[model samples]
Target: MLMLTLLGWLGGYLITTQLIFPPPPPPGDLFEVPDIRGGGLASARERLTGAGLVLGEIDSLLHPSVPEALIIGQSPLPGQVLRPESQVRVTVSLGPQLRSVPDVSGLAEDRAQIVLESSGFLVSVDTARADLPRGRVLEVFPRPDAILPLPARIRMVVSTGPALVAMPLVLGLDREEALILLDSVGLIVSEITEVFRFGRDQGVVVEQEPASDIELERGAKVRLKVGMSGRATEQ
Candidate 1:
């Protein structure tokens, strides 16, 4: 009877401890951490779960090349062994940083370039004819206050001063004709002087201050000397 009772007690204890409620694994047992970099957060979590690990603290930061929400760094790096169910911390990318374009219009070319470069932008210079002084910035592409990714290429339109036009021949023509020609060529007749002359030269242009074919800016002032048969007067 005593032997049977002892056997029954041992059987009950085995069933309760070994079968119904099992003990925890030995402390020395560990699992190898899997590589989870360059992957999305969800996928990294799934990978960690499969490797008998748990996802821990998640951090994020702006990256120039990595896509948003993708893992960029991992703790307990790949191939490192750790206790099963260990927490693995990770850092994900928030994508590239954004920057606002600065106002550089009316600034000197060198200064404009400096401002743009200081703001982390690439600059390209192009020239255009404008009333502004040469080497001054006339405008900027994408305008001011525009938001774009960092290291974006910017194009600046710089002024090369006003456009130049060749002076037209006005001597030997009648006053009316000279006026018409100058007006058509964007030249303004600032002053006219009348001189007494004889024969066919009467009432006609005899001389000009800036003789023909001289390069001048549009809307430049021109002085003319016209011939009058009976009067010497300034107009």
Candidate 2:
């Protein structure tokens, strides 16, 4: 009877010991951290999860050489033993830092574009006719000395040179002569209609469209009315 009792006690002791304290895990059972630097946050998290590990707190900072949201560094680097309940901490990049817009007014288009791009800005060009020479920057949006985020798009207004020209008089002249006169001043003949008048000779221009010396755009069209003799019979 005593032998049976002692056997029961030994079995109970073994069961209690196992319940109280677990055996240490084998070395190979631990997770080895993977190199995740330069990888995106989503991918890093996936990699950690795949290795039987958890992702820890993340830190962010501006980094010129690293892309945004990518892992720039990590705590407990790759190949380290990852404890079962431990997490991998990472530092992520937030891309280039912010900077102010420089004074690019009066600079040529190509030079301005290069300057802004080098300063980490995107560039857009708009053109307007101004007294400034063609291809010269007339204005910069957001203005100079304005604080802006990195890679901000800057729209520059460039000059397209002068646009206005004076209209020339071409009245009482032959049709071919009128065409030649208009062509010399960058103007085109839009229409040539005939009008009958007592004093004017046939095929001569009696009136001009935009009469003389009026400011207009170069290449504007001018209409003319030629004189037709009243004595002429209809065909």
Candidate 3:
């Protein structure tokens, strides 16, 4: 009875190992190579993986025939038999390496953004001084005058034209200081005399024509008053 049991166990083992298992079908042999030229890196990777092969490091080369991202050439060309798990090295075209960035300083923001995006670059705004409606091209990196090679992005700063800032309070500031503040905000100033200080502060500014906290148009002239008491000179 023991001998019979041993024989039965050996028979079951052979069947399971040889006929049923059979080394997992030799891991699905891959003896055929597929053409992956012109197929971008992503597509090429998928095909290779499907064929039980692994993609190796891809190198970029200068190829005049291939346009930018298109695959220029591949190794182990289409017909070679590749073993399963075999690594294939490939060289892809890096397109035209940009020698410099394009000039887009004066160009509108929308147009500039489009151009940069097409070149595979992110449109970055280092500093935005103005927005739409103010209308103007402030500046851009790489400059509008300079010529740039292909495969590069054009970064730019769009102008909102001129800045419109509310005038600062200058009631308490002295004449020179008030004039300085007015000039800083691009305001024009005219000096006049107000006789209200009653013998205090003669040359000192008595009051502003437009007064404090009043929003005046840019470049508009505002009058300044100086000095006190009944007979103040309105010069």
Candidate 4:
């Protein structure tokens, strides 16, 4: 009788255990994994959920061509059959890789542009007059060594040479007066042509090449046509 009572207690204990913890339902059946590559995270989640599968851990990686938060790869791949409610792993793209901004200051503008572009960065040129050499880069935006995403625009300050000096209007002025005016502005007389213009005073400038108000470099040459009392000039 004691053994029989022990057997009954054992049976009751087994039943209680079964009721409290039953084995998980055999994987709800198999379903094909949908292609989630190139899809955004939200869309990928929806698709996976609809398939009775769960979106698994996401791994982010930098891809040059893929956009951010888009799936670049998937575990088990697309079209694979797996038990329902199985977790699907995916690799998400963090967009293009970020690059360190190179030191381009003091480099020439064209050279700087080339270097930045080669390093996968876009470039913008801002010009200013500096004591630095013409076309040299004076400063850079985001500064050197700053990390930025690919295709990011990097603005650089470039020299537009020393402060601009507009050419003075020396037309109709006498040769002596024109010479003095050009000299005062760091310019020099390159050539002088004598022309005969009726009613014009001798040694008076009749025409000047490059006209006036045009930007010219220091010590640049200015050609002048001087009025003379003779018509013995080439046309």
Which sections of candidate 1 miss by over 4 Å? Answer: 1-27, 83-87, 102-108, 128-139, 159-163, 191-209, 225-235
| Segments of candidate 3 deviating more than 4 angstroms | 1-94, 97-102, 111-122, 128-135, 145-151, 159-181, 190-235
Task: Give lDDT per model, in order.
Answer: 0.91, 0.83, 0.69, 0.87
- For model 1, residues 143-195, the per-residue Cα lDDT tens digits are 99999898799999999977888889888888999999999988899999987
- Candidate 1 pairs with clashing backbones: none
Candidate 2 residue spans exceeding 4 A from truth: 1-25, 28-81, 84-89, 92-96, 170-235
lDDT per residue as tens, model 4, 1-235: 9999999999988887778776677665898999999899899999999998989998999987898888999998999998888999999998998899999889999999999999999888889987677999999998999998787889989997766568999987878899999999888788888876775667788899778999987767888898885655433
- lDDT head-to-head 2 vs 3, winner: 2
Q: Which ten residues in a row have the lowest lDDT in candidate 2?
A: 226-235
- How far off is model 1, as Cα RMSD? 12.4
- Residues 109-149 of candidate 2 have per-residue lDDT tens digits of 99998998998888899999976778999888889878777
**lDDT of candidate 3 over 104-145, digit per residue (tens):** 556767776776667555566654555333333467676655
What is residue 155's positional error in candidate 3, in angstroms? 2.4
Model 4 segments more than 4 A misplaced: 1-28, 32-60, 64-72, 75-81, 84-89, 94-96, 166-215, 219-235
Q: Rank the candidates by TM-score, best first.
A: 1, 4, 2, 3
Span of ten consecutive residues with least summed lDDT in model 1:
226-235
TM-score of each: 0.66, 0.43, 0.36, 0.46
How high is the lDDT of residue 48 in model 4? Answer: 92
